[model samples]
Target: MLWLLMTTGKCNLVCDYCGGSFPRDVVSWSVKYDISKLKSTIETRDRSPTVIFYGGEPLMNPKFIMKTMDSLNATRWGVQTNGTAVRMLPESYWKRMNVALLSIDGREQITDKHRGKGIYKRVVENASYLKSLGVETIARMAVTMDSDIYEEVKHLVELGVFDKIHWQLNVIWSERWDFENWAEKSYLPGLEKLMDIFMQNLSQGILIKIIPFLGVISAHFTGGYRGSPCGAGYSSITVTPEGRVLSCPIAVREKWAELGTVNEFRLLEDPLPDYCKTCDVKKYCGGRCLYASNEKYWGEEGFQLVDSVTKKYLRMVISKLPEIEKLIDEGVISKSSLIYDPVQDSTEVIP
Candidate 1:
């Protein structure tokens, strides 16, 4: 099982997509439950689970992270951070981490525009620093209208600091943009070009770890995934600061998302809706995202609009399978190279 421990609900930067920290009313700024209780609860469920530190900015409570890591006998330790406070937790602690996901949306201009000025540089520097320590560093991007997916992703790949790159479209929870126009005009076209680059890299014996493509393609060979690809309600769950276990981490305030308290938690029988099970691409997409499907943040029409992107993305990746197989057959790339992100370390496979 994958356990996402919400270290804190406080954040230093207010990114445009998420709008910074959760309200104190929704989630406490600091942890309210005892650390020993969390450790005991987790031990009862799974002796050595994969633990990932999550938050408004997990680094805000470095003490909590260090304390929890010290107490829990986790199989792996990972953090989804904004990359500003990498130094807060010393090098020794960082070297122990299995993965470190840094949020930087492509290039300096785009990232700074959304996150704030100087955030891009700081994130890149921290990513390089983490990479130097032999930690698996991932450049996580939140794609939006301002983003040119192909260019931004390509730029980050060229940086050579990150071990992998993952992106999620900013579609859920907030009516902010022209989804239809942006999808057709920018995102879809950018994805086509990005797919071309992905195949080119594969043929040249280089796996440019673009997770969305790699994850979906991996599912194609592994008989596909059920429920959420990220395992929101199935294999993965979130522990809030107040000790509430949520099916989806971002579904912070939704009553339906509240599974139970950490001390006495039970998994939902069927977190996904019936419509997801009946979808033609359910096998490949794995219901896209559990929160998005349930919330319907964009209404049915807008929800399907986002779903169209997933369908198109699925087709694009599936279309390249033959060539990818050819590359494998010719010894240009190996099958294992395509097998990535097996565990839900905060990489929502279907962007």
Candidate 2:
């Protein structure tokens, strides 16, 4: 199991999608804790759980991070960061964690447009440093409308930078990913072609997980059942900086959610929505967001939104599975087709 041990809500950069503060008026990071009963609330178990350092950006509170690390014996430590703040952290910090999931959705242009100027360069440098210390490093790519997946991916291959790279097919998180022809498919021509390269290169060496896409192929070709293992609430848990534990990261504030706090946040009695359990599109959609499923947060509108995105992407995944499988069966592709990480390991430079 994975626990998102959030030490801070502070971030060094802002992007278009998925910031904890997007829905709130509060922009500054606040250090809040209801710690009077913290230890008493911690539930002990036979096995040690993996801890993931997630934050507005995890590195924003190095002292808090170190303190948290000192307090727990985790099976594995994963950090999701903006890269710039982490670069300023000491080398000892790099050696502290087992894996670092660095987000690199684009090169200078698209990256700078979203993250900030020179931020992409900072990530490259920080990754290089982490690898020097033998820390397993993986690149987390969130494909956006303007993101040139081909050029950016080729850059990684040429640099020999990442041991693995995970690709997140662009989804309209809150607002539509604004671009000229995004919904039209031709907006990003590299969509399929770059996927081919990802499959091709991944087959040759290293590892890459293209996410839910992997789930799709796993089901159709391998006779996978029942639902896409979105891994939320089951293998994955989300905790906010204030320490509200959620089922899936996207459903950070949905119904019957917030399992409890970091230590006590256990799964609810509800079965995972049928969409995750029975829908073929579950492989690609993961039932959309539970919060979106909530009538309070999104009403029928949210449900419809989830449906639209699911149907839209499921068709794409179904259409491309044959091609993805052909590549795999013919030895043109390898992992993500054969093996899946479910976020345990990512594709990035680790040498």
Candidate 3:
């Protein structure tokens, strides 16, 4: 199904790095649905696609949110949010919602370190509370340079919190955190450690659902998620808050085409071109992160930074197959759902 990012551009924190925080309170959803854009998407429904609640923090303006959701007749609804706001939502809101994903990070120390302290704890309590409330909670952690990943991950699962955990290695901007001559909270070395831990953990036969990082490997194993040479224009399309449509989320802001809005309901009719199909890494990679690719910060440092990270990850996954098999046989893994968590109590191979 198609994915509609039904969100207003507003967030609590001014994370200098995050794209969402830009232009400051841009889409005043309380005033109106980005009508021009919203109408365009709504009029062209993608066969009853899903409307994902992307946000600066969706709950920031709850009044307009219900109205916005009411406008969407999506076949399914998914939301990504920091758990803290969930508490503000009443019991009725929870029972009526078809909650898809709940985004929260690792431990108290690391998450709070990046997202703000005590934020991590509230997220934990929130995620656990959601699960207790019968909403399947998926833990989403953005692994960054400062993350003590294994340690953080271990703690989350070990605490017996969350229904399922998902992780994405933070895509450090090559321009901002380039491998060469960079010194601001960079984690090139730590990422290598993470790859090693991945192998070690995978050898133990547990799997973790990592996005983008495990892209090609995941594609191959799953038979395919989208398409080969799959850049946004090909396999997917993204719509901005202003109703600007583009090939992908990473495309230049000004280059964004004014596609119809969620209210109008039109999906991108065209797919990616021959360039995508012809690329050597198409079947495997689908092309690297577009946002990172277009960066002028690193200049030629792009390949050096991204390729190095991808290579280590791919190699680690492939080499650990035998160990993976043993872990599976021993019942340590179930459906590729574990990560390098020395902190978890240990994958339950036995009842």
lDDT per model vs. reference: 0.87, 0.59, 0.50
lDDT of 2: 0.59
Give the lDDT of residue 136 in candidate 2.
74
Model 1: lDDT to the true structure: 0.87
What candidate 1 gets wrong by more than 4 Å, as runs, is: 342-344
Candidate 2: list runs displaced more than 4 Å: 18-43, 46-48, 177-181, 187-189, 199-230, 250-256, 269-271, 274-278, 283-285, 288-337, 343-351
For candidate 2, write residues 1-351 as lDDT tens digits: 566655565565777666434333222254455433332343364155667777667787777666666666667777877777775556776687888888887567877777767878889898898888887777777767676666766666566677656566454345543333553454235545656665565556533544444555555654443212434565567666666777665554455655776556676444346545756555444454444454333345544554655565556557866666666677766635455544364221100
The TM-score that candidate 1 achieves is 0.96
Model 3 TM-score on a 0 to 1 scale: 0.70
Q: Which of the two candidates, 1 or 2, achieves a greater lDDT against the reference? A: 1
Q: How close is candidate 2 to the true structure, as a TM-score?
A: 0.75
What lDDT score goes with residue 99 in model 2?
A: 85
> Which of 1 and 3 is the better model by lDDT?
1
Query: Model 1 over residues 153-179: C-alpha lDDT tens digits?
Result: 999999999988999888867765797
Q: What TM-score, over all chains together, does every model reach?
A: 0.96, 0.75, 0.70
Candidate 2 C-alpha error for residue 315, in Å: 5.9
Q: Which candidate has the top score in TM-score?
A: 1
* Candidate 2, RMSD to the unseen true structure: 5.1
Best by lDDT: 1
